[model samples]
Target: MTDTTAGTPAATDGGDPPDGSDFGVGEEGSDDPRIEFRGGKWASTLPLVFFIAWAIFQSGVLGIGDTNGLVVGALVGTTLGMFLVRGDWKAYADTIFEGMTQRVAATAIVAWLWAGMFAQTLQAGGFVEGLIFAADALNVGASTFPAAAFILCGLLATGIGTGYGATVAFVTLVFPAGVLIGANPVLLFAAILSGAVFGDNLAPVSDTTIVSAVTQDADIGGVVASRFKYAIAAAVPAFAAYLIAGSAMAGVSLEGAVALRESANALGLVHLLSMGVVIVTAVVGRHIVEAISWGLVVAVASNLLFGLSSASDIVAFTVTEAGALSGLPVVEVGETAGVGGSLYTGAVGFFPLIVLTLLIVAMAQIMIRGGGFEAIQTFLLDRVATTVRRAELTMVLGTATINGMITINTAAEIAIAPYVARIGEKFNINGYRRANILDANTSALGYIFPWAGGVLVGYQVMVGPDGLGSQYGPEMVVNPIEVVPYVFHGWFLVAIFIIAAITGFGREYIPDRASEEVSRA
Candidate 1:
């Protein structure tokens, strides 16, 4: 096949560089007919596919929520990649190590530091109390509780700009409480995961959201607003499903509604500033990490200077928590209660999740570099994605497939985003539209299947010992795992995405000429 002149910018310049060099355009040899689909390419995808199947069997079919299964899946997938590649075993092995070092090793290090600081700070500031205050305000019966929790948790994550943080907070605070109140714990956990999914995908301050917009060369607000329809499309059904499940599973418990409300109100729960600070900063288009970090700083200052907690106490609390999570030694507390308190809790809370995410990303990088992604891309572009509808379907399927393996929705977004943009551009899809679709599927699939990092994190909370009793006060009924069968929201969200993609409903933006810009370098 001869190289044809690739499509040029439509009147808007599409943000392509002056030479029309974005999207790898003008790169010679990409269109070479002899660039035959290679065995290495197919082999690359094998690990990811195997990983997905194994994870699904472990989490969905067997219902074994342990991290052991995930570890095994990664190992098996890695082995398959090595076996399939025709290259020397040492090269493949070196690639594996390199992939692990580059993506997994790097992210794990960064996430640990960030998690340590954020968790310690938040714990010191009594972030849980903030959640408790919000939960108390809802005061809904079992039937409506799931929806209420979903919305509240979603809003919290969006405001906080940290889905993982929200997961930890909600699991620590809401999971046990939901079980005690006769709301299904699994359903409740799923609601929390779904909420986290929402925030992670759309929150201006969410890491995934930031990476998607910035990497795609689009403005953050444009990405968020353009994604509004896709997000809501998935969210509405998720909301309704939660409500229905809450009703059937909860069996009309309203016994402690008034008391919970009164206690929550008595705590002066309406301050809203911590949440407000994060949200407003995001809305004003600040970098996501910077905005959330600022919120953390404010939260810490509030705790110490404003007597949210004493400075010495907050410091000690954070140190203790960080040590526990990292499996590092926590020194004996000298004088401060709060500082020690926060650190001890935060690190312990977020460590496992951060590790899991890093490993998953590393495995994905291995698959990509090994050539599995190219095989799939070649096939999809040539056969499946031949038309606009098919291209969109390919987009959906591609996003879903990558998310299934990677599990961390945000990480999955980054893994698959280049393809989404590339395929969408082929069909002249809009930038805003592509960004919205990319994020929406990332959010939806991340919470749908059991292997998803978000779901497992929540699931572990329900089945674990501390989760069932401490988080929920007296006054409720239900076992934690029993709620999984009733986790309606996760299922509903997937359905919504499928329907919208098929029907082309509520799509607002298409890629413009400017979308092809090299905003990042």
Candidate 2:
């Protein structure tokens, strides 16, 4: 393996040096004989095109709506890509397998698994019940609650670095409380989603943030700082929007609303400490996997010590005789260990998504080796991306467009990152600026668009056919489609960056100063 990042250069403050030596290249790697695509750049990109098209058909149009289906599509799509290779058949096979097992993809997959377990454990431990108790104790008016919720949920998402987790948390806990206290259903759900957008764009620990930084060669701290202005530019208006909407909307109570207020428990608040552990550890520079693991440990302990659920129940997985895995191990078809605890379900729920991501990486590697990556870079630099302002705008809109089209925002980000890096470097755009452009829009549009993963994640928590609404009471649920028009922050953030790109409010060039060390992120 050759160190493509071979001669390390010292980084400085202000902006990145105008070092064009590494321009127009993908990640650091030595020349591998099998990597060269026999097909032209266009041919090399066929696999990626097929994969994205398949995702659109499955998740965007036909609405299969299950990630595993997309996983199967990617799996088949990548194997088909092998036919385009011009070299040894064995080399092509090896690259596909190698990409499916890449560190970058695996790292992200592991993080998701851990985060899932942590979120589920918190739920089982009555984290929502604790929040409800606090909400009732605080005596916030039902109408004013949506405005307050926007602020609180934003804080939690920013601290924890997972907007999906925040959306799930607020949907389960505060949402029910709001319904009980007479808040408008659609308006309240919008507020919860707005908070998710706020944190996902600006939080250092966010997966999108990490992806944006590493891919663009920016420090995490600098990336967060550079984007804060854009976030605030959009946030102020969004906050006011929530307040106005909350005031105009009326809260209506449901059957369980009263029961919820009466049954709020204070002991479940211990999970707040679990959340804090994750925040502190992540902020102190620990690996996300390690930080989330610590949080998971603490949450399980809180569940047992606080008596939220039994130890066995917390770790349960059901083995039903008629279930999908009828003949598999302890999961017999007839008898249903109750092994499917929040921890178990949460962790496993992301399995399909993880597999899909790995396959996407395999597709990306195909594009890179096949010269498709280089071809796109050439087009951007020689044509549309002419000026610094135009380049930055292209980065912003490009990210937004891709994220909007792809149901999964992370995959969209990965697909476009190489182009962002190559184009930004052409005009000497700072890594921080590139990262901000990549992430802010990636986070915003994911929730704003109808087909996006973020919006679906929240919807699944609320009124999806299998959602808790059936179990907890249908009256408290809000329709996902109805909530789209009210998602102020996501739309506002997109507008802010578009405006910023044109007006040069937040854009920076490498010549402006030295670049910060990217490793710090």
Candidate 3:
């Protein structure tokens, strides 16, 4: 979810100096060292550029939503970029390790793993079935399901402090149920993504929040406090839009809708307490790992104690034939079986995404080391960002552009952070303002694009062998492309920032107020 240590020097992940000094921008009158590229600074962008083209071709053109395929693309792109180095291949190779080891990459991977497990455990406990029972009892039909889903998913993401985790949890547990209830599949999926955007932008403990504050040298509390206006300004309209669109959109007609609702049991709702445990613990400043572990323990206990799910259902080890372990509750002999259960499937589901993240970050590291970032910053500062208004606009557009290119929002934020700081400080912009601008675009664009991490993560839960399609039929699956235009909150947030840039809405200068010292939350 969130890392309290994100602001501290120890959180560098090998990117920054040991003393926590910023990268990308060198000190006054000093030139930052850069790896020479054969074709100059622009050539350093080949890896990311190649990966983006590959992503657009695969996910957008061919309509193949495969995370592993994207991983291959990133790998190939990174390797291709290597041959273009002028000399010293070792430095370029080392940058890959440097990028992969960054705290930003590790933080995202850790969240995905833990969130995956927690979501699967809740699913094992019939959390979706419980929601269906509640919906049926309260008369929440297809016309209202999307709106309700948006609100609920937003709340969960806000509590957990990780939009990726919320996306996984809701897509695993909520998406199918919404489709089964006859909600428009594409719209429902978009609603989930929109909710993620809201939480990712507004949540105090969100990774983007931490990164934005720390990178801008501002207090986390002040950054969160100042951005509330912009978040709510976008959220209110987004919620209304969901309600309006939910009614206008045509839901899928499902033959089993009534039957599924009838079979749903309220007992499954006990998992709410399990989810609450995670939210409360994380909100109270507990480590996200600890919070999710507590949630897992509660979910498993609830499943067994309330008879929602059996021990074997939660985690089972299977063999070809009967064995000594077969006597155990979690062990079995079956025709086709192996180690399979919530824990295994949940954690394994994110493996492709994890690899892709590492590769992309490695590519970003190469760009950073080879002067791609510095070159871009110099051009913007010299040619485009001369005035204060232009500087803020440059920051907004620049952040959006980087996020558009990178799938992982936090990594994108980290890569663009130094530029945001330098550009904003050049004009004496408030640290809070800079952090907000840096994070809003990072949070919004990360979920809006078809190949974005938030969108891909949710898409992965829909089409796999163990996904919603297998459980509720193929009609329940929502393609990532179809949901692109409907992530209302993300689009709205970005638009709000663009307008804020032009109209000076909520704009603050450094002279308006000085930010407190950055500290670990």
Which candidate wins on lDDT?
3
Can you give the TM-score per candidate against the true fold? Answer: 0.75, 0.80, 0.94
- Where does candidate 3 stray beyond 4 Å? 1-31
Per residue, candidate 3 scores C-alpha lDDT tens digits across 260-294 of: 87879899899999989998998887778888899
Candidate 1 lDDT (Cα, 0 to 1): 0.59
Model 2, runs deviating above 4 Å: 1-25, 28-40, 43-64, 72-95, 172-176, 179-189, 247-255, 317-338, 459-466, 473-484
Tens digits of per-residue lDDT, candidate 2, 98-152, equal 6666655665567667776787778778776787787778877777888888887
lDDT of each: 0.59, 0.72, 0.86
Tell me the tens digit of each residue's lDDT in model 1 across 1-521. Answer: 52333466345453443321221112211332211124645556666678778877777677676665677777777776666555356765665554454432343345334444554565445554554565555565455666877887788778766666566556655554454445665567678877887887778766566556654556666677767766676688778778776767643345554555344322223224555665677667665455556766776666655555665544432232334443423334333433344544555544556556555665666555655555667788898999787888788778877776677776677667767777877887766667766776777666666677666665544444334334443322233234444445445545555676678764433433344342331
lDDT score, residue 155, model 2?
A: 85
lDDT of 3: 0.86
lDDT rank order: 3, 2, 1
Off by over 4 Å in 1: 1-40, 83-87, 101-138, 214-217, 251-265, 268-272, 287-290, 297-340, 460-497, 506-521
